[model samples]
Target chain A: MMREIDADKVAETISGLLQEGCYRLSDDVIHALKLAHEREESPPARHVLGKLLENAEVAARDKVPLCQDTGMAVVFLELGQDVHIVGGDLYKAVQEGTRRATTQGYLRKSVVDRPFSARINTEDNTPAVVHTTIVPGEKLKITALSKGFGSENMSKIAMLPPAKGRSGVIDFVVACVDEAGANPCPPVIVGVGIGGTVEKCMLLAKEALLRRVGDPHPDAEIAELESEILKRINDLGIGAMGYGGRITALAVHVEVFPTHIASLPVAVNLQCHSVRHREAVL
Target chain B: MKNNMPIARAITLPLSDEVLKTLHTGDELLLTGVMYVGRDAAHKRMIETLEAGEALPVDLKGQVIYFMGPTPARPGKAVGSAGPTSSYRMDTYSPRLIAAGLKGMIGKGMRSGVVKKSMKKYKAVYLGAIGGAGALISRSIKKVDVVAYEDLGTEALRRIEVRDFPVTVVNDIYGGDLYQEGRSQYRIADLRR
Candidate 1:
């Protein structure tokens, strides 16, 4: 049975999700931060964490953005195979949704055109980066991530030789965090993707961020890897707001996929404490 | 539990020469009074205007520049969610501005060696706003108005009035750097070897 969804409704749903996502942070991240506050030893680190908690409260109550960067709108769509859209094209509707979110919600329009020359602002913040995957269900799921560039700018990817093996992956991930230092807003959530093609691995890293902060991966080995990486990251002492402390990472999320025998690719995506993402089903 | 921590010193801006010398990296501050806001795009334009031998849009002497661009103001509010962006992107343009008598900068992230040298030479300090705490920071911003480059939208240069704006000194004229000091103090000996 085809589930006919009105495109206008899709736009409205997306707009609503983006607004709520920017204003109120999800419960999981907030909970993780609370845990992080207790774990930190440095006074400055603890102080910064307290301020972040307060900021989260202020953002929700006032309906103001959590960050001024407001970030590029990265939309993820899980479309049911049996769904049919009426009245508007899917991608166009997504763009319309972002436009409405920017203008109506008073969100910052951060998109621009022409990178090489004449970087003109796309004032409407249109053309959300829509990633669609067809699924078995008759219902569609929409997610919006307000991807702040401060952390996005620090993300790194590498195509490692298979011989470099497990230690190399661990080393690479750890070093990335160390080098990112105070830049990507420390006490960050580290997302790791292993064993796939380069682009696929990068995508997986971003997908890993959707997991609740510090939730273990289903695979026991991967879960162990996540814990080990988290331990080492905190040892770097790039604490809350990079003021240095015992909890540099609130969590480490690792996702892995099978790959060709000769290839081992890895990607790291860092999510600053802002960590804004929201989703709705329709 | 909070007894050991130093209280944040309140500052009224248009920072005077005497005030500049007293600030140290890691000292918490709550800023009041006015500052100008700019970022990558606005800084580039100001440098361009100056390079062309044209008059600059706003005065720099004894002024602070915040590396920020805010969300649109809500109903009856001056601005929305004003927070600092990364400062490194402004590194290329900062020395020139500092040389022009700018007193301070507010933003997050570490700055460049050149920018640090310029700060030492020009007697300027770098302050860091809490990254990702825009809504909390916005509460302190009482008013905002675009003073130049309105076409740039959020990146437009603006003059703002603030009360108890929160910041920590990351770089000071006396060669203190909080990021460096903070990291070393807490870094545990490598447990992985």
Candidate 2:
């Protein structure tokens, strides 16, 4: 049996969260940008970085959007088995909340009706990408990660042979980022999903990005490997915005999922310096 | 040495090969005067026009082209949140522009092979603006007019005049790449031990 919660309350909360998240860059993200600016070496890259810092400062001061691509809102929900979502529909509540936020939040309505023709703005940012999973708890936990297309476009999934092992995974990810170079905006957060099916790997990689920066991997051996890989990625000298530097990657996160004995699917999700995400539980 | 240069008022100046050559990798520029705005769509059209041996909508002789797709302006604004889009997408179309007297590019990121080759050969410079800084950048623009491709909406071509628009020289006339130069200076050899 699930206990019911007020739908209007949930909608209000979701709407506020969406607007706040879209309008402001997270503190962690701001800190990372500052750190990147301090560490950047190339004069040109540093100049550009200073501008980015100034932009963030101005945006924050003015209460304006940090980036034009407010991004497609992606909500990860963990529904409590004991809690019932009441009053109207859950998806509609979320969509309406997003719509309200997009309009009032002053976010750009990026979603279009059709892919090819009659491409028109959805007016309000509706139809947010929602992923829900049932959990054992009594609380409904929601996490949102706003993603822009530039960094998202650089995501990669590779079906590597099991024999190639971990080194191969590192190679593939580094190669992808290298090819992506300055395009994805370097000083990136790399999330690696290993040992899952192709689609699962992709999802897992994105999920891994939600992890805190600089947290060590739980598995000791894997932690050591991750450290080594991070060192190498930074060594690629992709730097800030691909201006060559030692801090190309701020952190590398790896998540593993069960896979077929013969297959190892690896996915790399590169997040830019502006990784905007927030979470709340109710 | 750069610290000595006084921060001046933002002003819009015309785009020309001469004005372009005066810029170096770390120079701060407030661009105005005459320049065409284009991105992927406009590039395709420009290339098609070139192939057809037809004159482009805007003359290319000694012009600088900005790579940007801006948000729709608020009521009665010249443009809205206009910022540079990615430059790499225009890599294939750049050499032609340089040959057609396109002397400068404004955008972020790196270009490869022929684009770099063309910049060096044609004496053009690639200026880098901060990515994700659209709102701040838009403040510098005082005027904008649609020159072509209105159907493309944000991706349409426009002529914009900006005052004290900030940019860093990423690719220089001598073939210097600032992106490569910046990272090698700060990357640590090892993180553990």
Candidate 3:
């Protein structure tokens, strides 16, 4: 059963998601923030969290950007095997969506054309980093994450020897957060990728973030690993915005994949307290 | 213990070295008056202009600069979601600006040792605004003007007037660092449970 979906619809949907993602934070983050506010023992970190809650409200109510960076738009597309696209090319449509959203949503044009020399703004925040996957359903899923570089820069990937095993992975992720300190903006949601080749490991770490905040993985062993990592990370006492307190991370999500017998690759992707993302099914 | 948290002071800009001497890391403040806003691109251009032996677009002497680039102002507003960005990216250019008599900076994150030394030598200060709280912070900005590098889009250099803007002293001229002091005060000794 093949369904023809218009490419314009994809663009329009993505544009809307980007605007909404920028204006208001998703509910999961809001809920976790409120919980952190209550659980936090330090007055300073608590106060900062309260202000962040107010910021979220103000942004949503007044339709203002939650953060100035607005970030590079990273979109994940899951195209159903049975769907056919009409009206335009798929990849071009995604870029068009990013461009329109940048203009209409008042997002900052943060993308640069060159990293090495004479770096220039792309002007429209176009050419979004798109990751596509072919899936078995009739519905296409598009998820957009506004990735701020403060945290993105702090993220790390390490190729570990298989002999080091689980504890090494745990230590690396925790050490990354410790070194990151307040720079990534605390109370960050950490995404961990383990057991794949390097690039796949990085992608898996990002994909792990798409899961609802604080939701443990389904597999019992994986879910336990998530809990263990979350505990160690929060134990750093980096606290909200690194003001230092009881809770530094709202959640830690981990995703795992089979890899070469000799390779053990792990990646960490940190999302700031303003974890702005949205998804649509078409 | 709570008394260590300094009461928020009302500060007017062009902060004198004598006044900066009294401030310490972790002191809260509400700032007023004009300040220039610059980010990665604007700072790069300003540094290039300086290195090229040309006068900067604005005189940094005895001035405060905010490391930020706000979103486009909504209709009728002065600016949109004006908040501090990470300051480390500007570290290389900061010491030179401090030497040029820049008095203060508003941004988040830690500063490199070189930048801290410059702050001490130049008698300047570094303040941290609450990161990711831009919407709440923007309400303090009362006026805005594109002072230079307008083509940089959001990274353009802008002159802004803020009233009762909230900030905290992250690095003081006396070598006190709030990020270090604050984090150390709360870091749990136990690495794991």
Which predicted model would earn the best lDDT?
1
Model 2 spans with C-alpha error above 4 angstroms: A6-12, A112-126, B1-12, B26-28, B32-35, B45-61, B72-80, B145-148, B180-193
**Top model number, DockQ:** 1
- Provide the overall lDDT of each model, using Cα atoms, as 2-decimal numbers: 0.90, 0.75, 0.89
Cα misplacement distance, residue A272 of candidate 3 (Å):
0.2
Q: Ten-residue segment with the worst summed lDDT in candidate 3 chain A?
A: A237-246
Q: A55, model 3: CA deviation in Å?
A: 0.1
| Higher-lDDT candidate of 1 and 3 | 1
Rank list by TM-score: 1, 3, 2
For candidate 2, chain B by itself scores a TM value of: 0.88
True contacts kept of each: 0.79, 0.49, 0.65
- Against the true structure, candidate 2 reaches a TM-score of 0.86
**Model 3 docking category:** medium
Off by over 4 Å in 1: B1-3
lDDT of 1 at A42: 86
DockQ of each: 0.71, 0.42, 0.67
**Can you give the TM-score per candidate against the true fold?**
0.98, 0.86, 0.97
Q: What is the lDDT of residue A257 in candidate 1?
A: 91
lDDT per residue (tens digit) for residues A133-209 in model 1: 99997889998887889999999999988999888999999999999888898779999999788888999999998
Model 1 TM-score on a 0 to 1 scale: 0.98
lDDT tens digits, residue span A158-271, model 3 = 999999899899999999999998899888999999978899999999999889997899999999999988888877877887777778889999999999988789999998
Error of 3 at B20 (Å): 0.8
**How large is the C-alpha RMSD of every model relative to the true structure?**
1.5, 3.7, 1.4
Predicted candidate 2 versus true structure: per-residue lDDT over A116-223, tens digit per residue: 876666767677888899999788887777777678888999999999887888888878887888888766888889977787899899998888776778989777
